[model samples]
Target: MNLDELAKKQSGSIPGYELVDYYEAAFPVYRVIVIVAILTEQNLPVVQEYILKMLDCGLNNIGDIGGFLGLSNEIIEDSLVPLTQQELVLSYLEGNSLKFSITEKGKDVMESLKVKKPTITSLPIVFDALTGSLEPHKTGLAKAKEVKDLEIPIIKPYLNKPMLEDIEFNDVRKLIKRMQKENTDIAPPPGELLDIIEVEKAWLEYKRLKVFVFYSAKEDDVMVQVFERTQRAPEYETRLLRMEREGIRVLRTVKKQSVRNGLLVENLSFNNEDLKSNEESIQEAEERVKILTKNLAEAEEEKTDQTSIHTIKRQLEEARRQLEIFQKGDRVLSTYEHRPILEQALKNAQNRVLIISPWIERGGMDDDLLALIRAALTRKVEIHIGYGISDERSSNDTYPVKKLKEYLSKSFGKYLKLHKLGNTHEKVLVCDEKFAVVTSFNWLSFKGDPNRGFRRETGLYTQNPVTIKNIIEDTLKRFNEASC
Candidate 1:
């Protein structure tokens, strides 16, 4: 039988033969041969020459099937190793030379091969527009071949067609619509061309999967270097082997995801071009929308409250009455009443712990308070201390500040910020901008001082963001001014 008749009969009835799965299994080797054979009927004797010729068939020719598959030569060869082991292709010594040719099985498989057309119809000539490789076209061909026999009205004419470089965008859209309408197994799903960000994200995902750090040294995009190594296990062959497997898996996943998303090279290129052309307009529109949104929000905020003055006065008086009553749950703490509450707030600090204690005696920076600061700092909580330490004072006020600085500098110095204030008596501590304390009781010296000698100290604690924000902001400003 002729090649066409043989393909038609055996392609249907060949036992255990699935064009899609087989083609996928045999890939680039299947692709490389088909592309080369179709481009030039003359069977090239040399494998390298054959590969190079196949490369020349397309715009990109970065040596071997790597250019076509958008992968490295090592990875492509690794994939071919399985096919070699399967005995699908024949390789034997021919007159002191290692020669390779397609076996009968390979021929049958090649005959069954079909290339899908992924031509993009662009009005403006877009040469060298697509990046990476022409893998989609090759895979599209295989998928198209597998479904060539389907009687779908929309895709019938495009069956068995060679992959095209470009076609009308609208024509592609129409074909996709028809494919959706027919609901045939053979019709490839609509594809989206990945953009710059998406392509980078895919590469990042690939590197992440491979556990390798990918650093592109090419600043202006003239040259490129791809790193496939982990710092943890540098200069090891085993790591490279793992990386190869990971690279293959990641590539396969990326390809599958891209195809599933209906991402087409031609369409993607067209989309990028469209984006580039309209980027300025898009940015301008976004800015306009932002302005309009801000205006709308301000307008809403500016709308006058309809409540009368008499009603507002009554609400204010009721709020004052509630404050006077001191609700049971009000967390306002005092050194006399809830000294432990202060320590608990310090321990619970998650994000930021700001302490504005003007006078810090050596006794005030107690073991418990210092331990809490250390623990909070270990949890990445930022600690800012605004202290009043007079140089003139003997080993009392200045001594504690000096000791605290030394202790913090040893371990948590980087996280702990010391802002020395001149003489301000503000004693407040804000934790994570949520819980706060404004107290007359000195944070460092309060607990240690004897009740008989100590002044009648009192403090107010609040868990209000507004109250905390105002206190922190005002105290921080004062602290900054004093530090200056």
Candidate 2:
């Protein structure tokens, strides 16, 4: 039962090792694999190696643990300190060399998790008053592969039950495939994956409406809500809006139903406005489906005799490559609509962040932006800021810019560089020379204000290394020329 005995037993499992950790009880097997690989597989002494592994497992960074883990990164990160203190994990610096290694005690902690058993408990059953039905609410399951980065429900602390039935596996696989095809970034809820098969008919009635339901699992409550189509009140607006469009009236939930396994069901009713949209969407879908079905049938008949398996395989491979490229390079951002695109790019910047904005001032710098910069700095990301001085602008209007520069110099010291240019007006952001955003939007001044009739800004975001390299070279050249 102790850590030592558990580690010994787990070590016997060898390449097929199992991980057990009380603290990491809620984590899925894949995540545990990440930890196990770091502790046992990665021989590199540098903490950077372990960090890279986390990134490979879909974590943006050590700070972005919550983005993947569905838990606080700070908690996991802080736990490492105590791990070292207890001699469960060793940390040392040899002449500016940083290294991390799991001690024998650490292996014991992992071993214990492998042997741990889950506690069985009864799930809360929903009580439907209107139907007077006492049917047990069935939980939905997603294939583990589909929700690889999603936080899956743990049957009990440190215990996870595997999917058993072949029918269920095939069903979940199809659902996951559909989800991946439709939305790559969206994951299913903890307990149940939404069965779109049953909803497709109803969904087609409003297929034209851009609607999405994102769900999350709290301690004892499963929160499910639809994405906002209309821009809410001023106070409700986020720092970034993914879609810049006017709102339309939607189907509203009328009566709340009881919860089962933390899943809350509700009765929804559509108003006249919603019904009108639904009718339009249904007609469009019918016409579109008819055309698509006809085209598909013709294509299939033509290909049936002519198409070779090898040729089909090659076509699929090519299609996958194109999809990957499109997904990476297709992110076009408008500062007039979405500024968070740039903000997120900055937050995810690991090695460097290069900004070329003609004007930079403290007035436009919000707390969120400041925090992002500071976080990047903490990760040792180089910050290069290029700005211009305008002849039309007053010399006395330099306080905000001056304060910003002073703060950067004082805070980040050697990692920060501020370049003053002569009337430069280009705005671009390049991160690690791997991702770049070139925009007409002022990175320093513009925050999407609906009331402000500012110039509608447009920007292109690309992950193409060649494109990023060209932009970086050109921007650096301009910065150098402006200095002269």
Candidate 3:
């Protein structure tokens, strides 16, 4: 069906809607109601409003279509554009504005997504493989007036299939209650069955249109996006050696898995290394969980009932711990978000700018991020970029200080005093003491479409003094202190 006819027939999610999109096709395989709950019902109207008013894409310029639909101008460069890189959409420059329209595949996705106007009963919880994660669901059911203990149901995307009857929703509800109350503790399920039950329970509530299924592996994606163009060689042993300390492989891998597969290019050959590092991270996160659990246990022993403070603190601790793991490093990390909502995060930082990228160049970066950097420079943000040049082992075509020096001079201008430090391999950007964006992105990955610059790369952004000091001081230590 044509776009206009589909619109007419669908009538734009009219009242009393219970519609769903059962994607029998590829990309965004979601049940209709679930789609509405996850990506659309809540934010679609906002997007519609923006398109109707702000954007003016016509017969002339239609640069990146998915971006136009998926993001506002502010986050288009960081989030939406990265999606385009992953072939999720298409985006390019047009005059002063970024005029975008969806690709045929994206359009097919739009058609495939089941949309409906769900009741204001529940919100979505998407378990991203990459960016962010989920906290166990707490409906305030026990906190609320219990109504016959409506067995906490587990929902699934396979909407019509008969659910297996063995798992009891009652036990699951009790488990959620313990998790929520910390009678037990926060954890991944012990086995595949528990995991399935977890999914099932999540799905049941989800079916009531409670959540979404935008499966995101942003962690791995974030790693892949940032590390692709990183210069890895046999010599200048620091960059290569640090991987062992961090339990990551030094070399990058670049290959496509199969014949039908469109070139799967993985440059960071440190797969085993990364896996070990990631496992260590997970274990550390769990350790923190144990600490919090201990605290909760002590609190429970002291009191007859758990208070709101404990609950909030428990949630906050877990979320914060996860954020730390998330902060480890990734390709497309942002200082803050500015999409579907407007934020002036970068506004007040016109005084002193500090940027440190390990490799410093690659992505389809001739776009918005560069625009911001230039704007900062024009406003005399006093840019001080510190890059760590890895000791060259191979003498290959790797761009060392000379290449980086040339790129900085060529792209950022002669006045751009980009400082080159030795011995560090972290990606960070601290903007004018006002904002700090700590990431895993080197200079090349930041601008590389091959890095998924626009999609959903995860990083930590903060104005909080605690977060700021931790990132900046640690990075500075890596810079000033000498280590081989």
Candidate 4:
């Protein structure tokens, strides 16, 4: 299901709370490497199997066995000691030479030589950073710094560095056993975790997940539900709760950041395009009704077949009904149409462009978008930007904004005006007084998050001259009201 439907379904489950907002947020995870020893089943070496076969075949002397196997006497002697210790081979002194023979135990072992036998070995084990659970050593994990898209509003890890350091051998051993029981293919079977040789290394990482945030003003409480692969992730829910108990308050922090940055907003509203489309539909229906009415009058005057007159009346009635529905139904902008509309406005604007977004970050101001802005500036189009939703400016990377400002200041500064507002959630773009867009999308801070899937962002696109003029004027008024 779509995110909106999913949110609605989740909201119904809550007693008195409503789904206030949903956003893509980061879940803290750690990648830990620990050196450990495990007792596991392994296959017997080929050389040992070959020696048993030779001894069973009555090739007893070490020199003769080595010659048959194309190995030296020293290698054969080394292979014999383990076999003899295991009671799989019998050694005796005869005629001034040591001789060997395969015992019943050795024959039995030979029958299943290809099967895995019990052995203890040392290897590196990687643990799931969040749950302190065991993960396969070769599992691919991303480093926290390497995550590029999670720029703001992070959910802090409940499991901290000190806690990672204090992870004991017994803890890892239990985790391994638990994993083994859960998934044999991932953590294999018939194995016992031995001693932890050392805690090798640990580093922070993030697991990206969709979060639905619900709040009840009456109770002054917030509920956060994390989703992975479209299902509720209880482990993450527990982690978030523990984080709250520890006074981290990640949900509150995320909500505050999202609100300040205009990432959270109410549902989309009717746009001017909706009214225009409805008007067009009503006009088309009126034309149809007129044509059908003329046909009905002609059919009756001409004394045509009763069936023809009846058909004309039916068509006219249907047209009138459709006209009524078009006049009364609510209208909305299609969710898919906003991005291209904004891009086209950016590309085609001639005289001026005004943008108001709560935050300015690199995600929205990509190289292609920068090129568009530069081209517009080169053409001497005035570009006015008003931003900053929180009283405290965002700590996100300002390199994109700074770079654009420097370029404009050096060459086309006259065409640029940058304003930091006290606080606003208005996401608008007006271009060349030709078109304007008011949206829930953060035009300067949000591009799109692929990991989070699609967000339900919608906007009104209007080419109405009066509406555009009013939007541009109001946007500039806010810009002028705020500090430059």
Which residues of candidate 2, in runs, are more than 4 Å off?
A: 1-325, 336-338, 394-400, 408-411, 447-454
Q: Give the Å shift of residue 61 in candidate 1.
A: 99
Question: Across residues 1-484, which tens digit of lDDT does each residue of candidate 1 receive?
Answer: 2212222222223233221100001111112111110111222223333333333353222234666656686764554443345444545675765444544554443444421223222111111111112122212232333322221111111112123433333443444445546764533434432111111111100111111112112331111111222123232224333434454221111100111121111111123343343444433444455555555455556763445444444554555454433322224332233335556666887778787665665334545567777787777778888765456532233445555667665666677887877654556777776666666655654322121221334455555566666777776676677753
Candidates in order: C-alpha RMSD to true structure: 30.1, 29.3, 29.8, 11.3
In angstroms, the error of model 1 at 49 is 99
Candidate 3 TM-score, true structure as reference: 0.27
Selected candidate, larger TM-score, 2 vs 3? 2
Residue-wise lDDT of candidate 4 within 1-484, one digit each (tens)? 6444565457546888755556556666666665566766556689999999999898999999999999999999999888898788999999998999999988988988843334444333454445655444543444556445435446666566523356676767776776677764546345676666565666676666677766666897767788974889877777776766776666533222122123222322345576677757866886788788888888999999998888888888899999767744433333334445556667888888888877777645656677787888888888888887674665134766776678656577788888877577777888786667777677766533333422445455556666666666667777777878
Name model 4 segments beyond 4 Å from true.
1-17, 36-47, 57-76, 85-87, 90-105, 111-126, 137-150, 160-197, 218-220, 228-232, 252-353, 362-383, 388-397, 406-417, 420-468, 477-484
lDDT of model number 1: 0.40
Q: Evaluate all candidate structures by whole-model CA lDDT and list the values in order.
A: 0.40, 0.42, 0.36, 0.67
Top model by lDDT, which number?
4
C-alpha TM-scores of all predictions: 0.30, 0.33, 0.27, 0.57
Query: How would you encode candidate 3's per-residue C-alpha lDDT over 1-484 as one tens digit per residue?
Result: 3212232233223333211111010111121111111112222333433332223333223334335566544543444443355343565676776545456554443444422232321212322111112234333222111211222222112222223342244443344444545543332222111222222322222211121111123332211111111232122223223442465432222121111111111111224455456646655675666676676667666773657546847675876669565544322222112110011322346566556654443221223445555666566555556654466521113333334345455544543565556534444566545556544334323221221212322333445555565556655554455431
Model 1, runs deviating above 4 Å: 1-331, 389-399, 447-454
Ranking by lDDT: 4, 2, 1, 3
Candidate 3: segments with Cα more than 4 A from true spot: 1-348, 392-415, 443-457, 474-484
